[model samples]
Target chain A: MSAPSSPVPAPLGSRVPLAGLAVALGALAFAVLPLLVPTYQVSILTEILIFAVLAMAVDVLAGFTGRTPLCHGAIFGVATYVVVYWSQQGGAPVTGVLLAVAAATLVAAIFGLLAIRTSGVYFLLLTLALGMIVWGVCLRWTSVTGGENGLRGTVRPELLAGHLPFYYAVFAVVGIITCVMWRFVRSPFGLTLRGIRDSESRMRALGYNVSLHLFLAFTISGFFAGLAGALYAMFNDFVSPSTVALSQSVEGLLMAITGGIGTLFGAFIGAAAIIGLENFVSQYTERWQSVLGLMFILIMIFAPQGVIGRVRDLLTRRR
Target chain B: MDRRTFLKTSVAAAAAGAVAMPHVARAQGGPIRIGLMAPLTGVVAAGGREMVDGFNMYWEEHGNEVAGRKVEVIVEDDAANPDTALQKARRLVEQANVSMLFGNLLANTGLAVANYVKGNGMPYFIPIIAADDLTQRNRIKNVIRVAGYTASQFPRPLADWALKQGYKKVATISQDYTFGHEQCGGFCQTFTEGGGKVLGQFWHPLNTSDFSPYLGQLANLGADVVFAMETGADATRLMQQYANFGLKGQIPLIGAMNMTDQSVIRTMGDEVDGVVVAAHFAEGSPAPVTQSFVAAYGKKFGKLPSLYGFSMYSGAMWVDEALKSIKGNAEDRDAFLASVMKTDLTGSPLGQTVKMDDYGNPIYDVHIRKVVKNKDGKYWNEPIANYPNVSQFWKYDPVTYMKQPPYSRDFQGIKKS
Candidate 1:
């Protein structure tokens, strides 16, 4: 099915006090969750935060550039493997994470340079192929990657030993990353990319280096995504071919579209809803996938623009 | 029809109830909680489900209580993903507060879980995964495997039996994962040590659908026997293609346990006739415990248990024996570990008494069986030979085995027998 024809109404004008109050209340509630809830709930929240970061990276392409990458998870997974391999070889954690992010961004830049020449269906297919190549390497390079047995034994920092401490660390990291991404999408570069999205030929005719802007945007997104993946690999202390599989990439895409495109906070809200439903629903019934699918269908049918987008439209119309 | 509106309301109602109800019912329990982490939904879902069923049947038979305490089972689906397995295990240990962990079916999941339990000091039992590293390179204090032979141990008897049958030269076809590498390496190492010539060895990628190229290469090798180590879908496809390639009876076929497992045997029919394998569990054993288990499992699940199901059932039974000896108080961790390590699992369907070595790997009989139609006119693996009291290293010294490189595709060290 196609995206909704009507675009989301941007809330970029003078800040409304009601929206600010809602944001404050949401932050307060999230802060108190670990203090009150069970450890399992805190773990679920950690997963949501990681996926939210991943969704924001997807938004850079799908929401801003009007290009959907089917292999962004592969980029994320490549960084994870890099960090895992480094740490397994007795490298320090800080250096391992840095090296991982740099490697992942480099791979993403190469991907963007190759895929920038293609558009539409070709872009999606090319990214899919690239992602599968990462998975194939992970599965075939048994000596280094452990093949299908998966690589384990990464050390977790003692500072983040407890569940609450890890959750807070994840919260702090994702919060800082999201704020930077917010400034990025609001910058002149971001706006020019949006214009290119509307009419690339017109932008090129106006002497804009459209290809260079798109490539940079893709690389920057990949950098932040690599950061997210490195944290995820450390959090689980394990890395496998599944982390880089196509299913994970599609999962990120679904989280972005289902949360609301073009909105930064909406990615987190979408992540919270999806991860919460998946973890919670599976507890009561093994047919949780069916229920999750049902929820997705209902959302697509009624709230075609996504839950956050639909809410924003209602508020805009009321005002 | 306002389907959108209806769906919207139903979705909201269902989401609110399903998502919110579990948290509210979190009162502390009275039973001794045992957590089972298995692949409930994935490529290995069928085997996982059967394993769960086997454990459940045994639990019910014992009245769902052990040593006068109510037994509570917390079932978590890992979906066969190593990352997910670790997450679910953490939830089980931290949230469910389970006393013990059980049933990790896949190899990587087992390794990851083994690592987690080792650090956390959780009492864990692995029933099915056969990667040799679990008992060798990755062995820890609190973890033990009660079911199935290690990948290296499985091929010892099969290689010896093949040599006894006068098949000297051999060709091997195995998947390229850890299980595959161990299987091919173990068989080749042992077969060569038995005064046999290795004509060829081929390693195929996991989930390979087309085996014609591998088969053609094997057909040209002129070996007297072909030893294979494919499992599940790969095994079925390889056997079917082997038949079409007209090499079924021209050369004898032997393999690790899973080549003719219960899950794939019926689909193979006469194609597997006279094919020999070394497995821990065989359906045609005539021991009283074997007959009873077969009858009860068949009655309960409408068929004989899959190797996974039987192994898990045996694992649960071991847990029961341990629990009875300790009277269900799992609080003293060291005492419980001692009791579990000393528990004797003898006189079962597996045909001999079982004991754990220093690394918590089982030392039991490995049945070298050949497939044939039984008196019931059904295909069964009848034991043609036995390697009793075999350890994980298959008679190799533990220190020397540890000194050698762990089995991989390129491994070439097998001591002369």
Candidate 2:
């Protein structure tokens, strides 16, 4: 089904305030949640913030670069654990995080370049294979990776022993990154990238470095993915290959699609929806995944653009 | 809808997906209605399904049903991930209205669900997934872990073997994660406590394919009896590498948790032999209960249960036996909980009396098992020694493990009923 798109009769400039107001409410809701909701809710919120960063990374790749990459979670998860592991060996956490990100960015760039040689499902398949390969390695390589026991620890400083500080820390980072993403989407560079996304050959004819742009976009996406991983490693105090598994990678796609791919808020919104629904469903049924599967199927069949897209359409229609 | 409208509509439609009213599950029949959540599918499918089967088998023979109501086991798949495990637990507690919740194999998931269940005032019991901290620092009320914590099983065996081999300057290479790091830490702690020196430690990405670097470093470290902590496919791979490096016989590898687990035996076959790891349970635990379990399991599934499967089998029956002891009173949340905390079951697979410590971890025998080929020509883990009646939580005092993380201190679950 076509998404409801009444030209945001309001220019994005005017809409920014509305979005800002919405974001403000969200932040406020989050701030008040610890008091009103249970500890379980707090844990779920922590998860949402982590995925928000992940989904935004995907937006840069699929929405801006217009390339469908499947193995981004692998890059993020690997970088996160490796960063933490290296740091334990007298490596600095910040430097470890940075190096892990840089390494993952390079890996993603190389993989993207090679996989981009093919398009459509073939490309998807290659990335999926890589993700599975990483997962297998995580499962197999014991001595170095802790095997399946997974990398566990406490990612707390003195300040993070309590929940509130960690919650806000995650929020601030996610909000700042989203704002940064907003700027990137509006920049000339972002516009040209969008142009490349729309028609790579035409953009190339217009003197754009298509491969370089794609490579650059891939690296940036990987960087953000790495950042998410690093944050996650600190948040959960552990990292496992499961985070980078194909299923996890697919979960990121589900979050993006569930919230509406192109919209920046949609990424977080989708994460909220999926994570929220999961929390809610699990609170009620052991068969929550079947419910989730049904929910996703209905969305695909009816609101292809997902909950956010459908909501936006309804408001415009009412107007 | 045009492009703009389509996008807008999609957003609106997405928003429309918000839930209408919150759902709640009321309590139903109570056969100590415990929700059993574990990995029923995926990579650990074989192990998980067997574990679930063992739980059911026990429930079948021994369950009395809570308060005269038929006991129901809400078997849910954890998918061996934290997020999914949490969800399944919620369903069992809220939707199914099970009085108690059970089953979490991984550490984070165990911590996550135990914390959640304790908050909601429902008792959650864990059959497997034995990280030291679960009972040590992260104890939650309404959370009873029946199995011995895995980390507690290692130190003595690791220390003894290291000393026997006259090994010093040890180095550990584990999967770079919590389970590996913590258990390996326990290993080093025990080794050093026994007058051994640790040279260095290395952890690799959990999903690494190449181990040339890990092995090369191990060769450089020159430590006797290299300690390995890995499970499932990872253990199998490391075992292969250990043999490939000619370190299996020469270096005398001692693995406490994953090295001699069921997954290792099945995954690596003949190569599994000679791998010594610390464990408290084995197929040959020697009790009539364990022997009967092996017999029944063998007759039914054409094989003997592994240490994990055997533990899970004993665990389920243990719960069933506890329920029977308390009878229908298990439906009473407080009464049932008190009964659960006071669990002291014997003649089970581990062939040792399992009495609850002040905290939930088992203060029972710790065994060192060596992988050996059985008459069936398949690798099986046989217990070489039983360190009977050892406290699983060595680092912490008895008072500590009862009220730990994932829960607040003074938590009622470990309040020593």
Interface RMSD list for the candidates: 5.1, 8.1
lDDT per residue, candidate 1, B16-86, as tens digits? 43232234232333577889988998888988898899888878988999888888888989888887788
Pull out the clashing pairs in model 1: none
> Candidate 2 lDDT, tens digit per residue, B258-346?
66776557646556678777776666555676678778878877766765566676776566666666775555678766776687877
Show where candidate 2 strays beyond 4 Å. A1-252, A255-319, B1-31, B63-67, B161-171, B199-202, B207-213, B216-224, B394-417
DockQ of every model listed?
0.50, 0.13
Best-fitting candidate, measured by lDDT? 1
Worst 10-residue stretch by lDDT in candidate 1 chain A? Answer: A1-10
True contacts kept of each: 0.56, 0.14
Which 10 consecutive residues of model 2 chain B have the lowest summed lDDT? Answer: B408-417
Q: DockQ score for model 1, please?
A: 0.50
